[model samples]
Target: MPTDDMTARPTTSREDGLAAEVRTLLRTGLPIRLAAGPRLLGLRGVQARARRPDDPSSLARALDGLLREQLDRLENTGLAEASRLLFGAEAATSGATLTARRQAAADASGYEVHHFRKRIEPKLIDLVAWQLRRDSDTFMARHATAPELRAATRPLVLPADVFAWEAVEHQHALARLWGAVYLLRAELLTTARLASMDAPATETDAAATRALWRHALVLAAAAEYRAAYGAALLDRAGDTDLGPDQIAAYAGWTPPLSPAADLILVRLADPDGSLADFTARLDAARGGSELTADWRRALSGRDRDTDPNTLPAAAPEGSTP
Candidate 1:
């Protein structure tokens, strides 16, 4: 929407639609996000917020409605426009204009764009899991002293969809979330998507730059959680019965499992699954599968995040890893 590009070029219908999306988020989405939260400040009242661990028939209806709205938005939204609103200033090539940066994302996304969606699929699955963690935390904080907690646990982990439905409604809140996913995917595809093609990237390339992004967000999230909630919340971030695998569905999530910080590590752990199958596999895993660090070993050379000698060696596949 900000029409200032150093290089002038013809625009397509999708480009125009992207510009409209940018305008919509900047105008409408941001405001809606600022208001909807655990506080429920601008939203009507207590009745709207979930009170217990139970997911009833009416709750299913509400979540479905929320999902439909979110899917509609996701269907219409452009990855580039989203980039502009979220990290465009940071992601933008320093010398390029806003229009140029946006155009670059659109180009990287491709004309038809369905295949391009595949690039970001795994990260989005991880996003849903992280979103659930945050939403459960928010929901519990809101109902901290609720009567239901007398019979249940603090920071009660609810169904993943409950958190996801709430997350999609607060667009700006989830921008950093999806931004990390998009940026990570683009980073992985630099050789295939950017270098061999004719396009500009607002960001991507330069491992140092990519590493900076990786650290920057994680540090920010960790610091924000500590500042917002402090020592009192730290005691609640755990569960004795759960291992890392089952923790996804059960943690109270103190300051550590911050989506931008800790959960990003899990997202980075495996980047191979296609989105459609990835979510299904995660659901199956949650039902009962040992989480393993085999994904970490899959990395070769510089892709390795940790020294092989330092990490526990990978377990054999299909065993109770």
Candidate 2:
């Protein structure tokens, strides 16, 4: 999730600025303010994932995700509740102003508005700021470790026709992409199950649904990448000038779908259904990913004239291919 935009880890002074920016965004709770907020705007990785860098809604969602993650880590229920109320993280208070949110927090926590403002508000903002700092560190560490990790992994045995470097790059990208998809899929399943029990819609529920949308976006991008790669392969095989439909007919290399993909496709078509609704449809379909089975079949198959013994042996664990 980290981007290439950050060249160095943030300093304590930079974190203090982030905290101030977070406080301003929380106080305004305006999309425009959030979109322009220096701290949020500086999250180039998050912005790059959005449909557009300037999208206020996407920026707001990212902010919400950070807050929710921090909230989930809190051990104190009172602080969590007060923080949620103060941030208008619930549907009922989402449209409330800063003063209204403060009063709500005060009423819920049995504290005067002034006292809550002087005590709780600052702490909540600091938490978010701390999370930002932690995220920056994580980003830097990931980049730092990536080269060593790649060096440790076995090299992929790609088709001879494909460019080795390009294939390796694609393989690495797909590995990360599918990892995200599966992780999001698990989260969706858990959240869907919780929704099936008839729980009230909370900010957490909304966050999960938004996460599904993000999963869908990633899938869509993967689909596009696969199509392009397939087209290139076809061209290399002397099959040129194929139309979109023709290319799509060659489904052997297509990204395999699961229940999550089915639900996402339906939601993409309608765009109005909730997580619960999608869960019901998904249950009816009872779908699962075919990726593993597909890979096994591809790897196990051979031509009639080909000798099985001539093929390369499997790469040993931790050995280079």
Candidate 3:
């Protein structure tokens, strides 16, 4: 006796047929065609989710839900608009003629009529076909055991958050500055912890320890500048006297060094120890070139070329990935 066939196999032909059907629905732009397309195509996922698989109204609603959910996930605005126009997703265009839909898609995508027909339209159809297959597979895997699970697993559409490039960069720079401040604080705490435990002072030289403290002070000052600058940009709920250029000048502002920082600079400048040298060095370090250089470096290091929309793997400092 021959064994029954139980192996799972790819359905390339069925998928191809579905893709062709989706293309027809997109190109026809006729209500009668769209209303009958999903049922005629025998979309298993749509049928499975519909209250009555055989009912055309139920299948149409299910298909609409799937398209809307997937379309909302698309980040590309132009492609989204094209898809919407082509599929008559908006009520205003539901009764539009095929030529009108084509022209609208071309205008939305910024493509010429010939180019949109030859390139963009095919891509739109393929995108829909792929979305349908993915949703179908997901529904089948989750709801095969109990059809009642469909309601709980149904997808929701939410608005996408879009930010300007400048705003994104500003926020990213602020984040980097704050991150540097936290790291410097952690190092300071660790040093204090070691001192409290009476760890060997030989681990770090006196000069190196002083340098670390100086760096921490400078970084903290930079972080403060960035916070105030960012607040000036975002806190626009009320009227302010400052103009845009005046606000921007804050980026290059030089903060005065703290007393501790001044003392450290004095010690570095005159290790031999003299009252006159201490006084002169302390006065010079208040807004000196060295302090300015350090502040500028700290600020520039935080101004990375990273895209705020993505979270790429960490790279070495001062390196672009």
Using TM-score, give the best candidate's number: 2
> Residue 112 lDDT in model 3?
84
lDDT of 3 by residue, 209-301 (tens): 433443434344443444556333232211222222233223322223455553454243332344344334433553443443443332222
Task: Please list the residue runs of candidate 3 whose C-alpha ends up more than 4 Å from where it truly belongs after superposition.
Answer: 1-15, 30-35, 38-41, 75-77, 141-321
Native-referenced Cα lDDT, model 3? 0.49
In angstroms, how far off is 23's CA in candidate 2?
A: 1.3
- How high is each candidate's TM-score? 0.21, 0.40, 0.37
Q: 275 in model 1: Cα distance from truth in Å?
A: 30
Q: Please report the TM-score between candidate 2 and the true structure.
A: 0.40
By TM-score rank, best first, the candidates go 2, 3, 1
The residue-level lDDT of candidate 1 at 70 comes to 35
Cα TM-score of candidate 3: 0.37
lDDT of 1 by residue, 143-197 (tens): 1121121455566454679655554433332243334444544544442344345
Better of 1 and 2 by lDDT: 2
Error of 3 at 120 (Å): 0.8
In angstroms, how far off is 185's CA in candidate 1?
2.5
**Separate clash counts for every candidate:** 1, 0, 0
The window of 10 residues in a row where model 1 has the poorest summed lDDT is: 247-256
